[model samples]
Target chain A: MLLMIPGPVHLHERIQLAMAKPMIGHRTKDFSEILEYCTEMLKKLFGTKHDVFIISGSGTAGMEAAIACFSKVKRITCIDNGKFGDRLGKIAERYTEVDVVRFEWGKSIELDEVEKSLAEGSEALAFVHNETSTGILNPARELAKIAKKYDALVIMDGITSVGGDYVAMDEWGVDVAIVGSQKCIGAPPGLCAVAVNDRAWEFYNEKCPFYLDLKAYKKKLEDWQTPYTPAVSLFFALQEALKIIEEEGLENRIRRHRELSAFVRKWVEEAGLELFPELNEYSQYSNTVTAIKMPEGITDKELRGELKEKYGILISGGQEHLKGKIFRIGTMGNVTIRDVVTTLACIERILVKRGIIKPVLGEIEA
Target chain B: MLLMIPGPVHLHERIQLAMAKPMIGHRTKDFSEILEYCTEMLKKLFGTKHDVFIISGSGTAGMEAAIACFSKVKRITCIDNGKFGDRLGKIAERYTEVDVVRFEWGKSIELDEVEKSLAEGSEALAFVHNETSTGILNPARELAKIAKKYDALVIMDGITSVGGDYVAMDEWGVDVAIVGSQKCIGAPPGLCAVAVNDRAWEFYNEKCPFYLDLKAYKKKLEDWQTPYTPAVSLFFALQEALKIIEEEGLENRIRRHRELSAFVRKWVEEAGLELFPELNEYSQYSNTVTAIKMPEGITDKELRGELKEKYGILISGGQEHLKGKIFRIGTMGNVTIRDVVTTLACIERILVKRGIIKPVLGEIEA
Candidate 1:
């Protein structure tokens, strides 16, 4: 079976085996070594000299941790262009005063608009670098530059892009970059790694909730431990997945993801389906997930159902307002060229059955 | 290797295998079923008809979730006896007006003293049923009764007790009981299960942190989902562990734990070591973790190191104030009589080698 959803993608075989490793006490010397090794590997993947802390939860937990711990300013500006971007705004609203810069669901965050919002006097700005909902990659470096010009800290959600796309937290001047284990890391879900720079730590609030406090995480990291019990098996899995990434080299892995994304996008165009994000001068498609407009006659349920039931392949549907109007195919994690080809073949067969496309050269028989 | 720590215990073979199960999309029908099935199993294990939700973190996360979501009243009473109880108090203090009822470590909460404290008017009462630091089981049923008499809600930290000790949440009038996966459930560490009654839900606050909010958890639970991405592999491991518990029957499993505790206590007495908790009319020993008074001749580092290096066994030392004074042995999770016997044998050898105890006839030979 092929798992092609946005996250919790099919894990590599080594990661699965690593999950079965014997349990160790969280305070033992063995665990301390594993924690140190994993932290070093994560720092390399994040392309940052800043500290990285692993929280034992999903990506949202990482997002919340950033908001809860880093939003110490009087006002926070959140750029909302898609579902994940909107989520950032909502989470920031819970902790501090938020100025939401809203955009259409399928569009990218315009640089001029984001700069204008930041110019309105904000202490920190939060945004999603890669919007998973609309399959659009926001201009992270440009936005971070603008935020820095205003002397405002930048919080970037790189959950879907950190391991798959190019994310340089320090180089981009991102105060905090949030990442998840199950996306491009090819590990199981449950761990969220946040790359935090010195600027963010300088503003750390002592009043932050204890469970989500970054200062506590920093203190525990000094001891090579977490403040609370972490997902031990998931840590083992993440270590193995990072080892695989190191062996393959980070640049080559990013290139492999780009190749897979290009292959999927090309196939979609050849099949006469429209890509959701407009390929314009300002727009950049995500290298992890590709959103495609559903054909007029094919419903999301029908297309996804046929693919899942007949071919054992799973894809994602549009979330929130765009539901049923668009479908998404994830190309990140352990997904290979073969998996993408198989998914495209399944889509072609489903489209043919729905009378949206015609089979060519004995395609129906095959 | 014997994993006799407080958590991340030696999981059963089936649970370990479940951790290796293939990944699935969290929004898929397959995940919905697994979520629903695991919730039901958790409710049964919690001995409650209340709603149960699993958060992808450690027991500390569950503790904070309860404090963050349920402490919206005028004043909360936190019983602070040991490290974990004081932690509850500290978390409560962060969110609401907390009246900490302090007690000495390794001593039970006197019912009269608790009643006197509750007479001062409180909206809620929070305490740990099993104090991992002191290895004492408080009088949960009676203390909950006193809290209910004052029309205050009861929040229980059942992290180390749920699956090993008998925990009748509904019978004890507990509004919320927090449990962890790696303790008595014999699963990997990642998930925290919270059982909440209707009364607790009535007080759910909109001001609660988004990631730890109960209302969002409830909304997602209705559709058999979580508000945030959960640790999916950990859920699979928990389900398998719960299945093992169901097969053994909760009563039988509780009884097994009791027998293990008895065995360990008898062995400790024979070896001339002292139990940490004083057995009195109001005091009860925990069936999960047993704290033993460290002898004068041995240091925590020396004793634990020798055991781990020579015999591949892992136990726990006390936390904070009790760090060097007491050592702990966990009798919970998938630990068996053979494991206990082996640990005892290893301890005997180490003690004799350190001149803390003398070897008997055939002891050295064996």
Candidate 2:
């Protein structure tokens, strides 16, 4: 069976085997140095010239840390376009007093709207780079530019963006960048990958809460240790995943993911179904999982169940209000164009046999 | 090499193989449900009728969570008699004002000392059962009973005690019980096991901090989920470890550990090395590790290093203030009397080689 959700994306057997090994001591001299070197490699992956720290929590945990580190303002504007975008808002609610701006679902943040919110609140701003809920990858670099224009610190939820493409943290004005192991990192869940710009660390240095304080972690990290006991096995697998990514060459890996995404979009278009998000603003990182609206007379639950139960393919149904209205598929992690095409072909069969859509061969699956 | 320095006690081949399994999607139905089951089993392992939550942190992280949760008061009194006791004091200082009730390094805590302190202050009392740092297991049940009398909730660190000894949660009247996977649980590090009683959860139900909030996690545990991504591989390995424990039967397991402790203590006395701590008031849970003061001129470091480097037996050299004074030989986990006899033979040889005592060995390594 092929799994084509945003994350946890498909994994290679080598990575899985590594995860299954007997766990080791996190305090041992052997694992400590492995941790030290991996952080350096992660810094390179984020394209940032700074320290990268790993937290033993999920992507949302990283989101919580970002808001905790940048907590000078009571009113922070969140540009939420999808499910994950709303999650960013949810995490911020724990720290910041209010969310100033929230965008519509399946829509990218309007630059004018962002600028207007920042001008009014003059506080911090956060949004997701690739909103997995609607497959709308925000133009963070351009958005960050607008944020910088208003002198608001910018942070991004790069959970699905990292490893699949170049975030170019330095090149973009992103102050805090967050990634997770389950996404493009090609590892299991339970680890949070965080890279904060020098500016954000400066912000954290000045005003931050206790638990999410990265500065406290940085001092401990110098010794290649977390202030807390880390998920040592995930650290082991993550180290291996990075090595594989490094051997694959970052550029080539990103290009392959983009190729897979494009292939899935072409097949979806050919199936005569309307793509939910604007085509021009689609995410290149996760292709197969787009917010696909149910065509007339077809419910998202019926289509997903048919494809999953009839064929051994696992795809994600839309989240929250989008449930029974939209379904999501993805070409992330170890996914290839072949897998994407095969999944589409399965969906096509279920749709036609159930009188939802006429049978059509996907480009690669056929 | 025999790894007998308390925990990471020793690894079986099957567990190591389990750790090496390829990574899985933690968010997937397969992985989420697997972890969900692991959480349920962990509660049973703790023998608690209340909520049992797993934190993807260290034994210290478990302690920190306890501190963070039941931190309703500013003054926390830590019962100190050894290295781990001081560590609790050190950790409490970071988040709260602390008071320390002292006992000597090689002595079990006197219940009178703790009772007297609890009567003076309106603060929670913290203590460790089976202090790995000193080979002295304090009478946690007695201490919890006294704390209950004073209306002070007890936070007990049971990292080394849980799997090896019979520590009844509800019967002992302990407010919060803490354990870890790496210790007597006979698994690896990267996870901590916690069981919060009604008394502890009462404090947790309020607007506690986020990362360390036991209440926030309690809600998630209702569905067998963590607030953040957990170390999935560790969770898998722990599930298997608990099954192994169940097959062994808890009473028989504890009995074996107690017998092993007596065997080593008897053998050490026969070898003419003085045993540290109160003989009657000791740790039966971790019977393998025995900490002894160095003979007249022999340093603890020389004894431990020679054993590891030459004999291929790894024992713990002392930590902090006890360094170069006491060396620890642990016999917990899957080690047996043969291991103890072999290790004893080596110790006798080393003592003779260093001219501390005459060589005497009636037992064979096999």
lDDT to native, each model:
0.87, 0.73
Task: Give me the candidate number with maximum lDDT.
Answer: 1
Q: Give the alpha carbon lDDT tens digit for every residue of B2-85 in model 1.
A: 898878799888998888888878887788888998899889878899799899988888998887798788888999889999
TM-score of each: 0.97, 0.89
Worst 10 residues of 1 chain B by lDDT: B357-366
Candidate 2: chain B TM-score equals 0.92
* lDDT for each residue of candidate 1 in A1-366, tens digit (9 for 90 to 100): 698888889988888988888788898777888899988988887879989999998898899898779877888999888898889988888788999999888876777887887888888999998889999988888888999999998899999998899988888899898999999988889999888998897667666677888788899999999999989999999999989888988999999999999888877766778899854466699999999999999789899988989899999999999999899999888788888878888888889877887654223221
Give lDDT: candidate 1, residue A91.
87
Q: Which candidate number maximizes TM-score?
A: 1
Candidate 1 stretches with Cα past 4 Å from truth are A358-366, B358-366
TM-score of 2: 0.89
- DockQ of each two-chain model: 0.81, 0.42
lDDT of 1: 0.87
